[model samples]
Target chain A: MGPLIPNEIITGQWDFVIALLIGGAFGFVLEASGFSSSRNIAGVFYGYNFVVLRVFFTGMIVAMVGLLYFSYMGWINIDLVFVLPTYLNSMLLGGFIMGLGFVIGGFCPGTSYTAAAIGKIDGMVFAGSTLIGIFLFAEFFPLFEGFYYANNLGNITIGEMFGLSNEVIAFAFVVIAIVAFYVTWLIEKRVRKNMTEYKFE
Target chain B: MNTNSSAKRKPNYLNPYFGGVLLGLLLLTTFFIAGRGLSASGAVKLSVVTVVNKIAPEHAANNSYYSKFIPEDGGSIMFNWLIFGAIGTFFGGMFSGVVYGRMGKLRIEHSPKISKRTRIIAAAVGGLLFGIGSQFGRGCSSGAALSGTAAFSFGGLLVMALMFGIGYVFAYFFRKLWI
Candidate 1:
């Protein structure tokens, strides 16, 4: 009954429109949540703001549980859903590089896009740099092509790898997120005292 | 340059928990319809491909990275789902900014301790790193961390962990730019 595109319940013509609406909602959520600010995003690291951590983990667990439930209810075919493939070494390398970027740049790709849309010059610069970076990668892709394609662990999920049922893992993440939310709140309180530049409204 | 999120007539940002739930539901809906989660870097990657193809047709044709996305069926490489998603994201963000009154002016966001030039350099360097990393990481925070973890992908989880974990580790060195 779902995954309308692949199942052909919703024809190919509607693909672009649906993508637009979904992306719009995604952007709207990020922007309204204070993700348009570099400082706001960086707060997770400094402990002045835990908005990023809270929003990120909450969204993760919610989607996890929702997907599990939808699959349980037979509302969607789990197999048809796209699972991000794991390219171990390459991904690890990638994540490492991106981590540096996040702290230095203060916003990631999605957040940066929202930031740019909201008239953030830094966000705009960051977005433009990504284009240049990609161009650099494409041009020099041959140098690392061997390494990039080296570790291809096809379409595997955490629950499958750990031998835990989806529900159990989903519940674990929910617990973790709850604990994190509480702890971060406490941390933010202590940290904000020293931060004269930022105060929660 | 002053964000001053103080008590103003402007609309305040929504609660984090609510925003999370909305984002999650949106991701779920996206998967429910397109069988994929949201992403931003993919669009940028394709955009690069399009530009390279236009500027240096022979070079793009020969390059492995650019050639992969050129479309054997003979059309613009930009005719992909994520590109439309990126377009929607721009307008959606703009709409929210206008509604919240957060978009009247353009400025560089940084900590008071850091100079504008310092902030700009940091942002450019950081963005440059992300661009290259996304190519390797397969996506950025939204693409890999948030969307990846939600889908429970192993590599996605790894990327998420490493991205945040590393941020925590190296944050102290770059404290001035943000803090």
Candidate 2:
């Protein structure tokens, strides 16, 4: 009954507009939460600040739990929602590359755009490099095409794989998030005490 | 001091927990309406497809990866939802910057220890790798890791865990860039 565009509940010219509106909210939240600053985002990896971890995991858990609840209440159809098909080998390899990129670049694609908007030259450079990297990948698509499509698991979910209900997985994430938030708070306090170069500003 | 005066006027960022709750609500809204979570990389891929179609339409049409993006009865790739979303992200970022008074002349942000040149080089390299990686993985952090994993997608969980795990593993080597 939902996913308005796909279901014809909302159609014609409004689809793009709705997408923009949602994206605007997404960007505003990221920037306002200090994601526009590379230092702020990088702080999660360092023990100085755990804001990234808190926001990211909290958002994930909330969305997960919310979906499960919505399905239970018969408000939304879970079957209609899109799930990215599992390509185990490529996902692992790709994630490793992205991890390296995150540490070196100091900005993800979304955050880099926000950082660029706020006049960060590094952010602009990163954005440019992303375009170039995509171009390069396209040029050599033949080389990695096999690996990219390898080990397809047909949009499987963790619940299905692990024999657990979606609710249980969501609950476990909530618990994990709470523990992470608490642990990181302690770590941040300890790390900030020794730091000489960085400040909250 | 002059610095102290400037610092006093600078807007304070939203508290992390508060921001997280708000973001979580936003994510929830997205699922309810769109039946999916948020994504960022798809827009970038759309941009790539559009560019390729323009310069080498034939080649782009032939490539399995690029062709998937171009509609069979093609008109303009710029009309995609993801492209519009990205434009909105730019505006949203600008709006936030305006409210916070963070808008100003462009400059490279880096740790005091690193030179601007070093920071730029690293950023470019990192972005290049991410570009290629996202294609292979079928998504990036926002698309695959966050949204997919939130839906309990196996591939999504794998990417999220591995990406963060690898980030921590390699973070120490890049300590000077940030810490």
Candidate 3:
């Protein structure tokens, strides 16, 4: 009954409009959560701030639980949900690169945009660099084409790989998130006590 | 010193846990309506395709990577859903900025230990690497890592693990830039 466009429940030229509204909400949340600041975002690694961890893990757990519940009630069909396909080697390599970028740039694509909106020059530079980086990738696509399409694993889920139900995995995630939150809280308190340069805005 | 002084007057942001819940709810709604999760890097990819198509149509078409993005019927690449979503992200960010009194000024943000030039250069390099990596990984933090893992995707978990794992590994070296 849901996933309006894909299921023909809400067809027509309005799909893009719906996507925009959702994207807007996504952006608003990121900005309001202090993700607009590079220092705030980078603080996750330093333990001065753990906003990124809290929001990211919480959002993940909430969505995971929500989807499971929706399916249980038959409010939405889980079968129709899009699962990102896996390219094991490529994903691992790409993720490593993105991590380096995250630490170096201090902003991911989504956060950078919000930071730029709030007038952070580093955010602007990060966004500009994203565009340039993408351009560079496109220009040299041929060189990496073989690896880009390498190690196809299809659209498999963690549950499938682990031989567990989605509910079990979701439950584990919640537990892990809770533990992470508690531990990070302790760490942040200790780290903030020692740090003299950075201050919460 | 000016930056630190300005930061003092800024209002406190929402509690991280509270903000996380809000963000989680927003992500849940996205799946309920659109049947997918949120993304940011895909939009940048769309822009890249659009630009390449405009500058060198034949070259873009001939390239396997760019060709996948080009429409068979020949239309503007900017018409993509991700591109529109990115535009919406810009507006949404701006709207939040307006509400929070965070807009209307622009300046480079850097550690007192580092020069503005060093920070800018690092940002550009980081962005360039991230852009290329997203293509290989099939998504960045938002697409592959966050949304994918949320959906319980194996690939997503791998990306998330590697991304954060590598970040921690490299964070020490980049400590001067940030901490």
Candidate 1: tens digits of C-alpha lDDT, residues A15-87: 8888888889888899999989888899898999899998888888888999988999999997888889999
What DockQ do you compute for every candidate structure?
0.73, 0.71, 0.72
How close is every model to the real structure, measured as TM-score? 0.96, 0.96, 0.96
Estimate candidate 2's RMSD in Å: 2.3
* lDDT (10s digit) by residue, model 3, range A40-81: 888887888888999999989998999999888887888778
Stretches off by above 4 angstroms in model 3 are B1-10
Each model's lDDT: 0.88, 0.84, 0.86
What root-mean-square deviation over C-alphas does model 3 reach? 2.7
For residues B46-137, what per-residue lDDT tens digits would candidate 3 score against the true structure? Answer: 88888888899899989888899999998777876787777788778878888987777788878778899998998888888888888878
Instruction: Give a tens-digit lDDT track for model 2, residues B1-179.
Output: 25986478445788888888888888777777777778877888888888889999999999987887888886787897788878888778878988988877988888899999999999999889888778777788888888899878989998888778888999999999987
Q: Report the C-alpha lDDT of model 2 over A23-42, residue by residue, as the tens digit.
A: 89988988998888878878
Regions more than 4 Å wrong, model 1: A199-201, B1-11
Q: Higher lDDT: candidate 2 or 3?
A: 3
Please give the C-alpha DockQ score of model 1.
Answer: 0.73
Candidate 1: true contacts recovered, fraction: 0.82
Clashing pairs in 1: none
lDDT of 1 at B109: 76
Name the lDDT value of residue B21 in candidate 2: 83
